[model samples]
Target: MTRITDTRDGPAEGARPGALPVAGLLLAAGGGRRLGGRPKALLGHLGRPLVEFAAGVLRDGGCVPRYVVLGARAADVRNRAELPGCVLVDNPGWADGMGSSLRAGLAALAATDAPAVLVTLVDQPRVGAAAVARLLAAHRAGAGLAAAAYGGERGHPVLFAREHWEGVALSAVGDRGARAYLRAHAGAVALVECGDVAAPDDVDTPEDLRLLD
Candidate 1:
């Protein structure tokens, strides 16, 4: 587990000083109604659980102290997806919607000293570490907010600069996630074209999982 620190002292030897300090927050609080009440993050993909795969991607991309937001079947999901270095946080308000989970994640990120946060969903099993690294690299290059776009459709694992933390923290609970906020602050956004549509392929139903298989 790599420790997150203030990089201002200058990167170690050959490391770059401007490398953005970013933490990853995985939103796994969904109840999985479409999947028969199962925790989507706990669902298996090949030989690994979904959430574990997502965590692996973030970790490999150099995102430290990853936080997982659990809700409905928190225990079962947490027990089944025992990812190392992940901090599990329960969202009692998950019933409210994705907005609640987003807020909960933001609150957790707020507690950390990281200068930025990359938010992603647990259901998107195919979003790999390289994709996350791309977003982080773009953010470090001066983008206030960096996002992955597939075929021109912007999607998850959005990286937010500490400057926009307050906006995300104060978001209301509803079906819409951070689209509105991102749209309102379009001037500061740095859209990275991943050229892969699978980045936004979330397993919302059993059929979706089947498609991945």
Candidate 2:
């Protein structure tokens, strides 16, 4: 899971008010042990790297200045991933788990004037710009936490409210990311039904990629 929140009121000066302060946090730190140590983001999908597709979705959704958190094989992924305006962040503690990457991404977002963030994974090719926009709109419409749900299962690219930024930051430190944190604050979360079967599909192994093909 990835933790992204709104921080439009951050210390950063010159941030636009009511502009839906949002950032795109792309988590590219997975080791991909399931794929025999391959960098999943670098994997090809229809002639484009997985990371590119994910970034394109965020970009199309109007997510400004996306930030990608890298871990193992960071250099290779960075060089191969073709995200024109994305900012890369190296997460040295990514070995700990997805939580570490989330924290690192959040730390970088905190510096920006963005009040909300849309966090997604590089391996989830099924999640598109429409899904991201839906979640963002829901969050801005007063939901503290807005996430896409497929077949009743809550999935990635969750949009978090700025009020919960600190909790998300603290939760994303160990092996777990924001699962427990979101669960504990269930009252603040609103689930948006994606209905699309592709929304929950993620490429974690060669077979998963083949399925997409």
Candidate 3:
């Protein structure tokens, strides 16, 4: 792993000025099977691509060196979305499930100077920057593994300290996407309630498109 120089400005909470930056890993390679084979990353939200909004949330939350996994019409997403300053990773096996994208993101982060990673999904348009910030705050306060929760239920935008990246990558397979790892380490995960700040709505089938409205 190459020790990339940390150039992130305005270090986020828990990310000390001299310490490594926290990576924002966006898994946006879903093929949107239920949405008539449309790619979730290209779904429109707030007059822009869904990936744009999702990536913005991570950026605004203070995550540095954002990485977005692309699959299923990856070219279309790259051309249509204005994701400046974000590293795009291609996951050839994206159709296999979210786990592949998560693994790819982790692999990319492993080569960087990020100490932890905040993982978000492109289909989740409602989970915003506040929820991401809360998770980072939890990490800064000594929580090694933290996740955004809604009504006491674990949800997206999970934060994984560098120490757990390898484990998460290993467990990430198919669509489980860290479910096994998180479940095994449930006792250590800090569930930060974010229901008030954001909704865990997912834009999957046509019915789910209403969420973007």
Candidate 4:
């Protein structure tokens, strides 16, 4: 069973009054087979695990209830990282790929009744808090579908309203992960430009790791 630690919200303490509060859903379960089974969540960035940087982005961007989906090597991650205020969700089907983690993260939000969720990938350290804030601001401004656009190209850290959860979950198959769903609703998505503030370079191959300082 997926354990949702820190499930209590009560509007999540730090949310400003009248602000459109949303949960931050982090897909951090990748086993990184491409990186020889190294878990992406545990990858060191800035002397801290990548997950820590991601959570900071969400919090700084005003995401109320933060949820992190951990899969491959989940136990080791829990032991090595300090995700103090995040809801740690275990994705049993994580071996299947991003789709499983995506489903698990969203399902964990069932009881929170969050108006929306902002989803981000753990491997994109360069896609920092600033990009997240841009997408979050769009959500606050009532944009149902939003994402950080780099040079007008759609990318990660997408925001989906409450009503679109089911659709996203249904289409989140294999490693596609909301890609098909977002493509289906392109017109509805509000592209927030963040190229100036951040980049969405994912740390996948060893060479990509060089992007991190």
Candidate 5:
């Protein structure tokens, strides 16, 4: 496996010795390079920062030991966002792409013995808590990998078991993020239909921002 720099430093909380604590890992470090370099975490979403909204989705969905990875105007995000209990991890290589943020989130979860991380993106406001809840159900049922599928197409808020975190991290390059890893193990991925509960629209470009309006 390729060795990346340590993107995390502290221990959040230890999971029970026999239990697999499921954590909420929000990848909010995107700089929104295509969106006029605005940090997605600080983008307005229904009168609040998108990071807070994204984290709420995870929290309300029943994920414990929540952690948010931040970069690209990290200090500004901290000062403005209302992230009360989330562990804020800074990914120095965030400019490189989403891979770093994903890695940072998993690294932080690993420190606490969290067997799995329910991952979400800050720009994806349409993926609601129901979608995440479905994935959580699959994880608790012993699915090593799970993702919300919209019209049979895999989308964000994926779940990764502890055993596969390293491989997923190693394969997470550029903005692809776990795609190649999941592709290679496609047969093992549990797909949950989320179209009925949520829309997988993302706030990538200016037009996508209107979803929050």
Candidate 6:
């Protein structure tokens, strides 16, 4: 069973008055098999674990009661990462892939009052607070599904309204993680251009670690 540790209650304190309460869900459970068994969440960046930086991006982007899904070395991440005010979700099936972490995150957030959730990858360090704010703005502007776009192509930090949660969770299998759902409803997704303010390059291989530099 997944253990969802709720660190806070009530509507999102980070959201502005009369604004839609949106929760930020960070998927940081990858066991970097391509990086010699190291967990991505525990990867060092900016003098702290990568998970810490990613979680901070969510908080700074104005998301309250944030949720982080941990799987690979869950205990180690909890011990090493300083994620105050964020709900830590344990996803035992994380080895299964991103979908498991997504499902775990959505399940934990199901108990919240947030009308939407902004899903971000822990590996995407370059997708900063600006990109997140853009997606949140799209949601506030009446878009049900919104995603960051770079050079006209859609990318991460996707915002999903409550109505799409069930479908996304159902289609979420393996590493797909809403990819299929987003594709199925492409016409409705609001693509917010974030190329100027941020980048979407993800940290994966040894060569990609340079992105963190």
Candidate 4: misplaced stretches above 4 Å?
7-11, 17-20
lDDT of candidate model 5 versus the reference = 0.84
TM-score of every model versus the real structure: 0.87, 0.87, 0.92, 0.95, 0.90, 0.95
Please estimate how well model 3 matches the true structure, expressed as its whole-model Cα lDDT. Answer: 0.87
lDDT of 3 by residue, 30-78 (tens): 9989999999999888999999999899989989878889999987888
User: What is candidate 2's local distance difference test score?
Assistant: 0.77
User: What digit string (tens of lDDT, one per residue) describes model 5 on residues 12-104?
Assistant: 333355666688989989888889999999999889888999988987887877888888898888889887657788888888898878888
Question: How far off is model 2, as Cα RMSD?
Answer: 5.0
Q: Where does candidate 1 have its weakest 10-residue lDDT segment?
A: 1-10
Q: What is the C-alpha lDDT of each candidate?
A: 0.76, 0.77, 0.87, 0.88, 0.84, 0.90
- Pairs clashing in candidate 5? none
What is candidate 5's CA lDDT for residue 180?
96
Ranked by TM-score from best down, the candidates are 6, 4, 3, 5, 2, 1
Off by over 4 Å in 2: 1-20
Error of 3 at 152 (Å): 0.6
Pull out the clashing pairs in model 6. Answer: none
Highest-scoring model, TM-score:
6
Task: List candidate 3 segments past 4 Å from native.
Answer: 1-17
- Give the candidates in order of lDDT, highest first: 6, 4, 3, 5, 2, 1
| Model 6, span 13-52: residue lDDT tens | 5667766568999999999989888899999999899999
Candidate 2, residue 180: CA error in Å?
0.8
Model 6 root mean square deviation, Cα atoms: 1.6
Root-mean-square deviation (CA) per prediction: 5.3, 5.0, 3.7, 1.7, 4.0, 1.6
Against the true structure, candidate 6 reaches a TM-score of 0.95
Clashing pairs in 4: none
